[model samples]
Target chain A: MKKHRLLTALAVVALIGLLGVFNLTFDSYKLRILNLCGIYIILGLSMNLINGFTGLFSLGHAGFMAVGAYVSALLTMSPELKDTVFYAVPIHPFVKAMSAPFPIALLLGGIAAGIVGGVIAAPILRLKDDYLAIATLGFSEIIRVVATNLQSITNGPLGLKGIDRVVNTGWSWGLAILTVYFIKKLMDGSYGKAILAIREDEIAAEAMGVNLFRHKMYSFIIGAFFAGIGGGLLAHMLGTIDPLMFRFILTFNILLIVVLGGIGSITGTVISACVVTSMMEVLRFLEGKMDFGFFQIQGIPGMRMVVFSALLMIVILWYPRGLMGTKEFNWDYILQRKYLNIFNKKKKKKTVSEEN
Target chain B: MTILNVDNITMQFGGIKAVSDLKMEINEREIVGLIGPNGAGKTTAFNMITGVYKPTLGNVYFNDKNITGIKPHEITKLGIARTFQNIRLFKELSVLDNVLIANHLRLKSGIVASIVKTPNYKKEERHIYEKSLQLLEDVGLLDLINERADNLPYGKQRRLEIARALATEPKLLLLDEPAAGMNPQESLELMEFIREIRDKYEIAILMIEHHMQVIMGVCEKIYVLDYGITIAEGSPENIQNNPKVIEAYLGVD
Candidate 1:
């Protein structure tokens, strides 16, 4: 166990060093993709915590993300910038003069999303399975509609722009690493077991003294918190976001990341998040015109989604348990095996020598 | 002292009565067996007692406290834990984790402490881990502590359920069909294990079983249920020889 702890610490340090290298080497375009990947990691991990670990099928990521993005963007925008951006309809007086530091704004944004999640969870958590999914989907739609119609606060359909681009690889991936660490720590303890038990068998979990509603709320709220932070990061990274940007398609992308990665596996989510985010960007060309040597082909605008949908289906069919299922990857597992092999070899040599 | 009392409890699902007018009591450190033919509502009676279902009539008392209509988790927290009839182990979790989850009820650390991994929480977590290991050892699953519950053989899975229930430190443990899938020798060992647990832990045990050997071997008293009604209740010897039990098993001539 001591060796395992030391190995884990080393692994974390190595990961941080690798992130530092990526930050130093990547160009702005490449850094943008990396930043997106980091945000997706946060989004994917948070969604997995609710849908995978806690066994609650929620589809409210877009709603929570919207809350976070709007909150953070509104808070960090300067008073002058806010007025100029809401030129069609003057910005809300209360928020016009209000601005906070980047980190504080991100926190408030996450808390705002958590508060919204709690409110929605109160009534919707009672619904089970498909019904819960439908209700959360409806809630996300509601949030989008509100954001679109609330002209004074959200700048209406034109969307908020001229926001500060404070998010880079450091901020995005830094938060992602922090999010993963926090989730891992939580899952390594009794609290994590209680929630996972709910996923295994609700009745047996209840019989063993797991409070269903409380644990569900814990997973949901915490998941929302990280998701909100991810949304805030995305908004600051792009310096522009509208209600349209947080459509169900946004949540669907994160869901794809979660499902393809494996439901309850954090490492799986991290790997798949990186792969899926890059794949999405790479697939963008499929939606544009193709210039052949002789003839040019008109691109299909929605072909990217069609291909992605097909890919998701094929992946699910090929690996139903997902890339990792509920398993986690730890360096200790490999080290443990190596140690066992060495010990067995030593024992075999000792017995051979004794016989000789 | 009476550890559990089901006083005239009845459970109705729609028009059908699952358990009707059921009255049972368990004393400290006593092993009581509830036997019934298929659809005789033995599991239903267990469910009502453990707060899985609200009794349509009458009350359930745990240590003289009225606990009728309480939630299952609340009942468990109030010192009553139960294993399922079909063996409901957390299949994806390790055996150690299965028992660790059951120890959740005993944890006094708040969620913040659990998330933060404070010294108090870490200490409690280590204590729970050690205790879970001890419980698994007592159940003879120490060697497979890290194995996933789903990977265990049928007999070992049943044993895991018992270990998990014991981790909750319940005053009364309810076992439902614990010997269903076990062979004769394994069942014999299970009987001894059950008896040993009752004596060692000082917990009252109420188990529903179809295996007559297990019931007769371990239970000091037995209750026979036929069609949601108790046909006989007495010492195991008396229950075995009772005419009603024979008729309930073999049907009236």
Candidate 2:
């Protein structure tokens, strides 16, 4: 156990060193992608807590992100910028005067999203499965519509722009690490076990004294909190935001990462977030003109999506349970070389007779 | 020393009465049997006692406190726990995790404390882990602590379900069909297990079973229900001889 702890400390030090190297060496475009990867990691892990671990099919992450984005953007933007953006409709007096540091704005954004998540969850969580999915989906759309119509606060469809680019690698990765650490701690404890129980069997969980509503609320609210933080980071990074930026497709992208990574595995989420983010950039060539030695083909805008769909199909076909299924990336498996054995041999089953 | 008192509880759905005007009592550490033919509302009565269903009329009291219509988890917090008739174990979880989840109600630490790993939370977590291990040891599941619940044989799965209920530190345990699919020999062993748990845990037990051998072997008091009404309430021997119970089980010729 002591040795394990030592190894873990070393691993963390190595990770810090690697992050420092990437931050120093990477160009602006590469750095932006890396920051986006960190944000998505936060988003994917939070969504997995609700949909994958707690067994709630919540597709309302985009709504929570929009709340965070708007809250943080409004707070951090300069008063002059707000005035210029809200030319047609005057900005809310309270909101126009309010400004905070980037970090404070991010935290406030998370808290606001958490409050909204809790309020909606109180009524919507009473639903189950497909009904819950549809209700949450509807709620997300409602949030978007509200943001669009609330012209005084949100600057309507013109959106918020000229926001300060304050989010650096340190802020994004630091928050991502914190998110992973917090969720890991929660899941490794009794509370997490109770949440998993609710996912496995609600009737049994309730009978066993696991309060279904309370645990579900905890998961949903926490998930929304991190999603809000991710949104805050996104808005500040892009220096612009609008209601259209947080459409259903945004939630779908996070869901895609969670599903591809293995829904319940934190390790899977982190790895897939990085891979998918980079893959999006790498695949951008498909969306631009491709020059071959002999012939050139016209770029098909949105061709990246077709390739991604094909990739998703192939992954689902081969690994129906996702990349890691319900299993986490255990260091022991790698150390013992058991992962290689998994390909060579079928798992042995222990029958009742064998036990006897 | 009555631990559970049911006062004329009735459960009705539209025109049909699933259970009606049912009254029963269980004393401290008593092993009671609820036996009935299919669709006799035995499960519905269990649901009412455990707070899954609110009685249409009348009240359920645990330790003489009126607990009617309270949520199931609150009832559990009030020292009542139950096992489903269909064996609803958290199938993917380890046996130890299944029991630890049951111990979740007894945890004093809030979510923030647990997440932050406060000293109090760690101590409580350690205590629960040890208690879970001991509980598994008592139920003869210590050897299979790491095994997924669904991987257990049918008999062990039932035992795990009961162990999980016991881990709640419940004063009253409502088990729905503990010996549902057990063979005669397994049922005999289950009877011994039921008696042992009642003595060891010092908790009153109310079980619904069709296995007559197991019920008669373990139950000190028996209630017979037919079409949602109590037909007979007496000792096991008396219930065996009661013509109404016999008629309820095997139709009159």
Model 2, DockQ value? 0.82
DockQ of each: 0.79, 0.82
Question: What is the CAPRI rating of model 2's predicted complex?
Answer: high
Q: Report how far residue A318 has shifted in candidate 2, in Å.
A: 2.3
Measured by TM-score, the strongest candidate is: 2
Q: TM-scores of all models?
A: 0.94, 0.95
lDDT of 1 at A38: 92
Residue lDDT tens for model 2, B1-253: 9999999999999998999999999999999999999999999999999999999999999888999999999999999999888889999999999999999999999999999999999999999999999999999999999999999999999999999999999999999999888888888888889889989999999999999888888999999999999999999999999988888788898
Q: How accurate is candidate 2 locally (lDDT)?
A: 0.92
